[model samples]
Structures are given as structure tokens and as C-alpha cells.
Target: MTEPTTHRTEVVVVGGGQAGLATSWHLVRDGVDHVVLEAHTLGHEWADTRWDNFTLVTPNWHCRLPGYEYDGPDPDGFMTRDEVVAWLAGYAPTFGPPVREHTRVTSLTERAEGGFRVEATGPDGPEVWEAGSVVVATGGYHVPIVPSWAPALDPSITQLHSADYRNAAQLPEGGVLVVGSGQSGAQIAEDLHLEGRTVHLALGDAPRVARFHRGRDCMTWLAEMGLYDTGVAQYPGGLAAREKTNHYVTGRDGGRDIDLRAFAAEGMRLYGMLEGGAGTELTFLPTLTAALDGADDVYRSICRDIDRYIDAQGIEAPPAAPYTAVWEPDTDPTSLDLAAAGISTVVWAIGYRPDYRWVGAGVFDGTGRPTHSRGVTALPGLYFLGLPWLHTWGSGRFLGIAADAEHVTGVITGRKGGARTEPAADLARRRSPGEIASDVALAG
Candidate 1:
């Protein structure tokens, strides 16, 4: 027999990661009744990620929630995957938000009246809960998408995606081929090489970052200068500037001391890598120019702000580092073919895209991402936080999530408008049993 549907508070938060947890924390602080539904144990998904030496590109200070600081030794240092997961697990209980672990939300349907009915399955069985709103904090990085060409690769050679890669232990003894030149790919190549694996890094036109300190930690400076807030909504130009600068870091003050050139110098081989679908061959010249052009305004602003701060403090600003490499792609045919030489395992670190099939219909754009004003969806009370480039360039990044969450919270509590709601009963009737069952099965 089908179990009776359960009714809960006004808001239901799906996913218990940093995004979801932060949303719940804010909801509770505002006295907004909410329940957080986690499909797996808190931080369990990270436990299964393959990269062993994974560290957030963004620093720790930015890794904060509404009321809590991410207290750790190295505020400027990036946290390891374990540290991040542990931090999230610890942060979840402090707010005491009701978190239903292992509860998988299969389908979310909007009630015509105004609310939502969330169909889920847990250890018990099929369960349904009604909420005035739903917040999909299930981040864009959960699923690892390897191209179809991966399986077609010669099975004899060892190949693994960055998601399934843990450490050098998993790589073949001969050499490693890290596909995709994003941060993850570079880091993995470095890690494997350090572990004594001959590493070949497939080079695409990747973004570059300057490794220097501007003033305080880069994140602290960003917060102080209001970069995160500036990129939100009203400031579309600032948002665009932020997005472009994020493509590659400008060499200036104290920042990370790692970059692609540094990685190459450390003995990581570079080869040509491109999106299998994009016919355009990877080149450094135009890509670098694009990156530099995009980041120029943001970097200048950061420098100007630093100067102002230094002047205010009556402290002499240090000399800037000599800018060395311009943004450029390697178009050398020889460099592109290095993979065929001896590279074995290829780690795809090309970044993540949102997968929103569970969100049902009428809410997403052609790209499968939720369509919202700030965080409020067309389906009333349904909200989203921590989506990549949601409104601005920084929306998906660590510092940006907080801003997005705050805006989302504001929208949900009636402090803001542009939201629609669905009645619980009407939402339930909209979903087919098959769709609900499929979602539940995946969550399980």
C-alpha cells in the first residue's frame, strides 16, 4: 500500500552540500521553517571523488556560511577535499536544521495553487512531503561526464577522469596523461609527477592565474573591496568584468604561486587538448588576449582598491611583480601530439556543467540550468543557489555562493518579489508516477 503523504514546513532544501547547508542556515536564522533533504550521508559524494590532492581553487576565508567562519589554520590556503567535506559535515549541525540523510528527492512538482510537493524515497519507502518552497542546492558537480570517445580508447592504456582519480596510486606506473588544462588537470599532473609518475598534461587554451599577494588574503581583499557584492545583479558590467578576470588571474600581489608555466617547468609535459566537439584548434595567442582583455578592468580595480587601502593606512605599497606571460594558447602541432608519445592516463579537469533532469520541466533553459531572476524560480517558492555564473561571473564560486544565498533567502521570505508558488496538491497531480519513481531510484 502507498504510504500517506507527509506535510512539513514552508521550505524544503534539497542537497546538503555547502550550497544547501548555507541556504538552510540562513532560512533557520531568519526563523524560516525548512527541512534539508540529503540523498546521501553528509559530504559522502566527496568521499568518492577520485582526485586525492584536490584543493579548492578559492581560498578558505571565502568558504563561509551565514553565521559561521570557516575556522582553520590556513585561511589563505585552499582546503583539501577531506577538509572541505569535514568542514561541511561539522557546519551542518551547528544550525540544527532538520537534515534527513539518505533521503533522495526524486521529483519536485509545483502545485497550481502555490507550493510544492517533493517526492522522495528513503530507507523506509516512497515518501512525499509538501513545502511552500523548494531550494535545489544540488550543485552542478555531482555527476562526472566523460566523453563517449573515452570508452572507445584503447582499453590497454590506463585512462581515468579527474572525478575518479584519487592519487598517483591509481595511475599506471609508466606515465600519466592529464586531459583538460583546467585547475584540476594541472594539479593532478603536478601531484602524479611529485609521486614520481611521468606526467603529460594535455594543454587546451586554459585560463591563467597570477600567484601573488595583493594585500591580505586575496579572498579577504575581495570581500573588503566588495568584488563579490559588485557582481550580483544591478552591476551587470561589474559582473562581466568579474567573470572575465576569473578566467585567469593577473600577476600582482600575493596570490597562489602555481600557474601552468610553473607546472610545466616542474617537468609536466604539455600537449594539445581541445573540446572534442569544437573544431577550432587550441591556440594561446587569441585565448590569452581574450582572458587578459576580460580580466583587465577587474585587475585594475583590484589594484586601485589596494592602493587606496594602503594610502589610507599610511603604509607604502610594495612593488608589483614583473608581468611575464601574456595569455596565449599553444598552437604548435608538435606540442599537440605529445600525448601520442607516451602519455597514459588522461584526467579531464575541464570544469563542470549543471545537470538538472530531476528538476522536471518548465523551469530550465535550453542548457538545462534553472531559469531565475536572482534565485527565485518561476515555480513559486522554488529557489536556487551556487549555480555557475547564475547572475554574475562569481555566482558559482565560493565567495559568490554566499551572496547568491542571501539574495535567494531575501526572495523567499517575501522581502523580494518576482517569485511564483505552487500549491501542494496541484504539484503532486502534475507528476507521473513513472517520473517520480525514476527520480527516487536514482537518488537511492
Candidate 2:
């Protein structure tokens, strides 16, 4: 027997994180009917994050949702992973939006009548929902990228990605090995070391930001100088540059800073990029900036903006010290055999990319990222929000998503949830040369 299909609301929001909740908040404010579908319990993914010491790098002041402020002890203080999860869970109830928990959206496609068909699986079995609009807020950081060589390591040595890591208790008694030098990697390395685990961090070409300067968060400096405020039109090359710089810094609340070079001074080993083969030695460069010159132009522009802002404000804030800290990869190329170093565990924290297999054609570029002006996708009534580096440098970050969500909501409601015609020149300019070439080749 065929189960009857169900229909409700004007829009459907996938994922229940900060982004999804924020979208729902906007929809309610606009008096638009919408339902949020979460695969697990509210904030379950964040609650299940492996890092015990994980906290928002951005302070509380900037972490507001659409209608609710992040009202906690320290407005400028960093929030732990638990605190973040709890806050997101509280948002929907406070705003009176219906968020359906444990509902996993299996697939989404356009309906025959020009709406959306969302197929989902829940405790009640397979269900089909029809809506006029869809918001793909599934988030960008859900999946972990484990290198293929990772499985070659001996099974006896416990290996887990940063996402699966919780506390030092989950690791073996001997010690631990942390791979990737991104923000998560660096923070976890410091946490394990503080927990009394003899830590060895595998360094990559990731950049670093100072924890604080002149008694203010580095992010505040970036915002005050209008660095994060620039849009793609004003700075076409800015997004690519920000991706390379790795400007995130770990906070003191998470753990004491374990400088990659200073790790060796504290009797911890630092290894650079790992070559393939059974026992390849790790190599290092003096500093990562040589590989990061492409990003320096953007940083210089930001610094210039800061200088101009200071002069215009006539504020007597003391200038920050000259940036002398050299964040370099490990130079001593010794093969610290995992078995020999008593390292029984490994954690990979490289980064994340979107997987849009379920999304049909015409909505995404070759990269699988949705094609959108701000949050509106290419297809009519299909929109996306809360993607990493979606528009600005901080667009997908905690502090930046709310503005994007509000803007998207305004577009949806103002036009009665219909697609807007793109100006020909604007459309042509948005496509990259490579994309145009691909289209031409396909036509030929």
C-alpha cells in the first residue's frame, strides 16, 4: 500500500544549528509559514562534537540570533561547545518556531507543480513534504575529511578525527598525535597537552592570528576596521585570499598557547607535511608566509583600513606591536615514528567542504556550492544559508550568519517567495572564466 504524502507550510528548513534556527526566526517575523527539520535532537551535532575544550573563537557579543541576544555572563567572553549548543536549542522555543527533531531529510527536488518535494525519514517512516520554498541550512562543517593514507596506519594505534574526539580520557595512556595545524588542530593540540598528554602536533601551512592586541579581541579589530564588512563586489579576490590566510586564533580560555616551535622547547615534537610511503620523513619551512603571499595583499588592505579608521576617529588607542611572531613549520626533519614516540592516537582537522549529491542540476556550480547572490540559490524558491565563507570572510562564521539570514528572509517575503530575474551583465560577471569555458566546451 502507498503511504499518503503530507504537505504543510510555505518553506522547509533543513538542519537545526544556528543557521537553521536563525532562518526560522526570520520566517516567523515575516509571518511566513515554515518548519525546520533536524536529523538529530536539537543541537545534537554540536553537543556530540569530540573536543571537550572547544569554544567559539568569536566572542558572545557577536553571536546573536535574529530575535534573541546571546545573554550570558561575559558578552565578550568565549563560549564553550556545550554553551553554544544549549543556546541554539533555546532559540526556537523562545521565538515560537516549530522545529521537528530527529527528522533526516534524505533528498530534495523540484515538484512537478514548481514547488519542492522534500523526502525525509523519521521515526514514523519515510515521509514526503511539499513546500513552496526550501532553505538548505545543513551547514558546511558536518563531515570530516580523512586522508586516504590515514587507514594505512596500524589498527592498533587508535585514530580519530577531531570531530570524534571528546577529552583526553578517550585517548590511550601513552600520548597523542594531532594532524593539521588549522584552528581546530592547534586548539586540540594545546588541550591534550594541558590534560597531561605528551602531545606531538603535525604542522601544515595554516596561518595563525594573535589571541588579543591592545586588550581587545583580534576579531573586534577586523570588524572595527571594516575588514569583514566588505562584500564580494567591492573586493572580488578577498574570499580566495581569506581562505589561504588561516586568520583564526585560539583563545586563552580553551588552553594555554602551544606555539609550534615552542612545543619542541617544552619537549613536544612538531612534524611538517607527511609524505607518502611507509616511513617518509616530515619536512618544514622556516615560516608559512612564503606559501601565503597570495593572502598578504588582503591582510595589508585590512591593516590599511585600520590605520585610516584610527586616524579618522582621532582615537588615541595605542598601536599594536609589530607582528614579530614567526609561525613556521617544524624544521628538524626527524622521522618521529608513531610507534616509537609512544603516540597511540591521531586526530585529523584539515577542514570541510560541502557535499551536494542530493541537489539536482542548475542550482550549483562545478564546485557543488549553490549559486546565490547572498542566500538565494539559482533555482526559483531554492535558497541556502549558513555556508562557510559564503559571501564575506566571516559569512559562515558564528557572528556573520545572522545578517545573511535576515537579508535572505527579506528577499523571500518581499517577492512572495519567487525568483528574481538576474540582469544580463550581472549574471555574466558572476561566472568565472573557467565556468564559461566549461559551458562552451559542453556546447561544442
Candidate 3:
């Protein structure tokens, strides 16, 4: 019998998403021999998981993936889900990322003698890889979560996690109940509302941010304000802030504020956080008003920050009025009768969590979170990247990938601490027409 093949490399970067690719970008510059292993094709999540009408909440400019910043026709504009996949797909070929597509890393264990062993199953079947260093860039969003009572709902009512949801037409012809008001929940709810379908939202305590504030995008303003540069150590809530639900906002239809109150005024129903459910009935808390008000508080706070910045900088900006609630719930409904309301679908956008047991128990804390400073774990040469606050606010996002990747690569390359931007001079390098044409044939 043929033995499972074993290959050796300097580094093994698991996950071929933007995070891994970003790491690969730096490794290539430093001339490191590393391979990125991905369970599926690169950017498959954006192509498969996101709703059909999905677009970026952050504008195109924030897609600064190490070498490839968004230089497409739309810099300020939000790219559609397909465009995002294309942009990511285009990235690997330009720099020729040594990525093994369709390769699933089953386990990563440390060798007793100063290296790591990676076991994976590829198209050629099972194989093992040995590397001096291992970077887990798979990120923290692995398992999609729904409430415990989801399975008990009536079989007639279609239930889909935000990860599995594609479009409104895919569901049964009836009203939709979107549980959770985070980015995905809010955007998906808006998508359904635009389709003229009845959307009953179960709002969570996640804050909302202004899409376009004053003369620029809120992200743009925040970036200038050094919000993205704030590291985990300096973050207000410290490490505790990492688990916070992201502020919900949208960039759909050229970008605008997501006001659940406005949505409510337009006939969409709003409920509080989901508590439990049985059959066709779902129970919620009496925090609908609190959630909306909390969201607005964040929105106004962000706008005020932008306003202060504009005033401080003595920059002229457009005038805007204070946001007032467009509508309010006459009664905070603690229960939603799906069958009675004609709701045939429940889109749960609660959130996701990663299971890191496969990486072994030594590196994780009691809470199952990686115990690392920046991306470096207690175990030598075993590191994590692309997780929220891995280094800074930008660490989990495109805006910070380069710096984080550079920092991690610098350590692997024996340069020690600090990220360098000098390598980015090679970022704008273009691919030949033939090279670009032959790379990554994707489907709509």
C-alpha cells in the first residue's frame, strides 16, 4: 500500500481566505517557502454563504489586502458579492500565492522536536505536511449559531442561518422573520424589504453606525481618527471587546444608514431579542425600544465624533440634522406567531463561533479562545492571524491584514517585531493578460 505523502515546508498557513492570502502575500515578498491550505476554493464564503444581493458594508477602499488594494472603477462604491470574490480571486494570481485549493487540514499537532505536523485531505487523498511554523488564519467564524428552539419550529416554516440564506425568492412565499440585528441580519432584512416582502425583525443589542457621515464614509473618518489603529491592549474594553457584536449597518444601493425605525415605519415589523420558540410561535424580550434607542445612541455618537473631527480640523462639511426616531412600536410584542403572521421563513443571523479543538488544547484558554499576544501563542512558532483584535481593530479586516501579516511574517523571517510597509511597493504589480486569464475560473 502506498504511504500517505509527507511534504516539508518552512511554514503552513491554514485557510486561503483574505487573511491567509494576505499572509501569503508577505511570505512571498520575504521569499519564504510556505503553502496555504484551504477547505474550499478561495472566497467561497462570499460566493456561497452571503445573500444574493449582498454588498460590502465598508466601501471598496477598505479592501487593502496586503499588496492588492481596490483600484477598480469603484473605490468609494461598495462591491457586490461577486465582485468581492473576483477581487480576492484576482489577488492570488498576481503574486502567485502557493495555495492548495480543495485541501482540508484535519489536524495540526506539534512535533516533539521543534516543528509542527499538519494532516490534511486533498484531492489526492490524505497527506501530511511538516513545517517549522504554522499560522491559523481560518478566523473565528466557523459555526453558524441559532437559538436552541430553532429545530422545534414547524416543518412548514423554512429556517435558514444567515450563512445558508441566498435570496428572498429561494424561501417559501410568505413573510420573513429575521432574528438578530447585526450586520448580516440588518442587511438581509433590508434585502427582503426591498423585495416588497414582509420582514419582521427581531432586533439585538448590536449598535448601528452611520454609513455616510458628513463628507465621507464613517469608516473613512474613523480610519483617519486612528480608530482602526487602536490595538487590543489599548482597546476600551480590552480583550473583552473582541466578543462584542459588530455594529450593524449597510452599504446597499450606494450606502445609507439602516434605521430599523424607518424600516418599521415602512410596514416592516420590529421585535426585541429572541428568547425562545415552539412550533409557529417565537418568544422575544420586551427590549425592542431599548435596542432601537441603543442603536441610535451609537449612530449619533459616531456622527458626533465625525462632527467634532470636522470642527476641529476646520473642514467645511454638509449640514445634517439630528436623527430622530421615524416610528416607534405601539406595543413591544413579546411573542410572534409565525403561522398567524403568515411568516414562512426564519433567517437567523445571530452570529458564528469557531471550534479550535483540532489545533490541539495547549494553545487555547479555558474559554477555547487562542491565548496569544497579537497572533503569537504560548507555544513557539504556532500562531493565529485574522481574528478580531489579533493585533488591532484592523486585524480581522482587510484594512489591517497587511500590517498583521507583515508582523507575523517578520517574526517567521527572523526579523523579530514590527510590520514594514516597504514591501508594499510590489503590491501594485500587475499580472500579464495570459496569467490573469488562466487563474481562477469562477461561476456566477
Candidate 4:
């Protein structure tokens, strides 16, 4: 959809990803006049930002984008990168959202007169749009975080953030040193390893989980257990859990546990947290064993939770088997010469930094995190949606966005002068049958 030079909308949502589109769907259904402004094409994050071999860690069934729930042939299977892109692209037209792609929001400020003033450069140069309320649905995982010490590495060795890493072929032919073992880092390491490349993994304390246990997807068990529905305020981590690194797992091929120990057993080099070094020398902490142990604890903790849930529900599932550590490190190497190790590339899978700087100053605290109660900000008429832990563990994921979108929309509808819906806290509080009342997104 095209926007005029000067335009007005009842609501303006900034972003065109699943989160933004989900909010747009709710607004459309409620008969709210709104426009969605996107910096890139819809689904560009899945298409461009992700690696070539990427598949969602979550199963296809969770790809519930408001009206567009996954009805694909294999709901339990993971969608390939192309499949995901197509699915997301197909979602917009189903509800006919007023989305202006490639229009980056440069600034958003609350107008003293009332409402909001949004400035952006679209296809037709600078454009100004006014709206009564604004929703920032640009989900977390924004800017790729590379350390300031990164420049100290040798010049010949290629450096790529996990965002820029498409495939092993993109890097020079040699061993690859992958730093950070979060979801992206672990998956990328596996991708490179599967391609028959020499992979050196720099481990962080990111937890790992099995894809399937007791003949069901872990997600399946968790969903039924209602772990995904955990609210931010109710979470043990409170809001800080939003900053926690996701567990390392995979839906690659069919889906399986990413056993870094297994990788080590297969002769892949493993190191501790990278501590940085100049020239070709790279130093590491002796955290590999501890990181590995910590990850195992989380894995076993999930198994225990599922076992307890099954027993409590009186469900006739198979007996749970304990996870035995496949391998253990004798001594973690503290340093390696990149040239000596034949590592020609370094993939920084550290993670992304949230960037809400374009939004007004009052929306954030000193730390720059947007402070709100389930997307409703302190300042009237402004909201946040699709942020990690905004409402629940599923809040930002495909598993939870539809309900969150609806809840945020409900809040907007009921704000002061307008009356279209009631307060939406209950929408988030809705529970599934037999779901553990105390179960959190976190297993422990």
C-alpha cells in the first residue's frame, strides 16, 4: 500500500515483521484505521538476515500470525528458509493490511497538541504521518553486537556476524572459529560442521535442549504444559529474562539436540568464552566445562518438568530416560593462534542489541529498555508490542503474538476517550486446561 506525502491515521505501527503484521491484523479486525511502516520488505528478516540453511527452531505449528496459522502438510516439521519467507509474505494480503514496505521510520515523537508525529523516508522521499496512537512492534534482536575489540583480530581472517553468515562457502577455506554458543551460534556451528568444514566452537553458557522426548516434540509438551503462556510480571526472572540468551537447539533436517560434546567427540575443537586477543592470537576463559555442565542441567531440568507434568496429568506416555553426558573435556584450551589453527573465519554469534532509540526518550529508562505494562507505556496513546517477555514467553514468538496483539489492541480501544474493548490483561491471563498454574517459560 502507498502512503500520500502527508497522511493521517488513527494508529501507526512501526515494523512489518510477524509482530507488526499481527498487531495490524487486530487493528483491522477491530475497525481501527492504521498503517504499518516497514524499513525493508515484509519477511526480509527471515529472507535476508538469516542464514541460507536456517529453519525455525520452533516447529511449523507455532507459526500462528494472527489469521494465518500454519496449515502446511507437516505442521510438526520445521519450515525451510524459503518456506518461512513465503509463508510470512502470504500472511499480509489475507487480511489486507495497509503496509508500506521499505519506508524506514526515522523518528517518532509525541506531539504536544496531541497524538504522534512519525517521520520517515519512503519511496517518495521524506514523509510525515500523524496518528492518535503508535505501536512499536519491531521485535527484539535488533542490532548485531560485535565487540569493540573485534578490530584487533588479524586482517586476513574474515569476520562475519551470524547475521551476515549465509553458508560455510562464504568464508575462506579453513577452520572457522565460531564465538558464542547461543541458538544462532550453535546452529551455525552445526551448519558449518555438517558441510564438512573444520569448526572450532567458542562456547558460552547458552543452554541446550532435546528436540523430542517421550515421542513428542519438546515444544508440543511445553505448549500443552502451558510454559509459553508465562507472563512477564509473573516470571521468576521478571523482566530480566528478556535479556537471557535462548537455549541452543535445532530444527535442521528433522530437529534434534545440538550436542556440542558430540561435536567434540567427532573431533571439532571446543574452547571457552572468548576473551579477545590481538593479531592472530585469541584468548579464551576456562568456562567450557562449566558452560557444558550448566547446559546439561537445564536439559535435565526440562526432562524432569515434563516427567512431573506427565505423572500429574496421569497421561500414559512412555517412561522418561535420563540424559547422560556424551563427552567431557579434560582441559579447555585458553588460547589459540588463528593462523596456527587454520581458522580463516570468525563468526560472532554473540547476539543482537535492542535498538529503540528512534522512539521518544520518555518511553525508556536510563538503560534504554522500553518500560511498559504489557505494551502500554506510561505516556498515554503510546504502546509496545512483540517485545521479548512483553506479556509471556510466547509474546514475541509466533506462539504468542496473536493474543498479545489482540490484548494491546484492546488496551488501545479502551484508552480514555475511546471505548471499543475492555482492559486486556485477562486476555493474557487466559489459561489452558491442566496447564501447570505455576509453570514458567523457564523450566527450573
Higher-ranked by lDDT: 2 or 3? 3
Candidate 2 residue-wise lDDT, 1-444, digit = tens:
558368667999998877888888888877898899989976677788747778877756566666676767565567888788777777778887787888888889888888899888877777787988889888766568787776677777787888888888977888787878777887888778778789887667765554444334455556655556567546766546435536536654632223555555676667665453243222344333342332234344545555566678784444654443344444445356777777778787777667878766478767666777777776888888887666666577666677778777777777354322222223223434453343233222
| lDDT against the true structure, each candidate | 0.62, 0.67, 0.83, 0.83
Clashing pairs in model 4, backbone N/Cα/C closer than 3 A: none
Least accurate stretch of 10 residues (summed lDDT) in model 2?
Answer: 419-428
TM-score of each: 0.77, 0.84, 0.93, 0.92
For model 2, the stretches where C-alpha displacement exceeds 4 angstroms are: 1-4, 236-245, 254-258, 277-308, 323-334, 415-444
User: How do the residues 192-311 of candidate 4 rate in per-residue lDDT, one tens digit apiece?
Assistant: 999999999999889888777775667777877777876877778688887777888898877778999999999889999999888999899999899999999999999888888888
Between candidates 1 and 4, name the one with more favorable lDDT.
Answer: 4
Query: Distance from true position, residue 149, model 2, in Å?
Result: 1.9
Model 3 residue pairs with clashes: none
**In model 3, which range of ten residues has the least summed lDDT?**
435-444
How does candidate 2 fare on TM-score? Answer: 0.84
* Candidate 4: segments with Cα more than 4 A from true spot: 1-4, 415-444
RMSD, each candidate, Å? 12.1, 10.7, 6.3, 5.1
Predicted structure with the largest TM-score when compared to the true one: 3
Cα-based lDDT at residue 209, candidate 3: 90
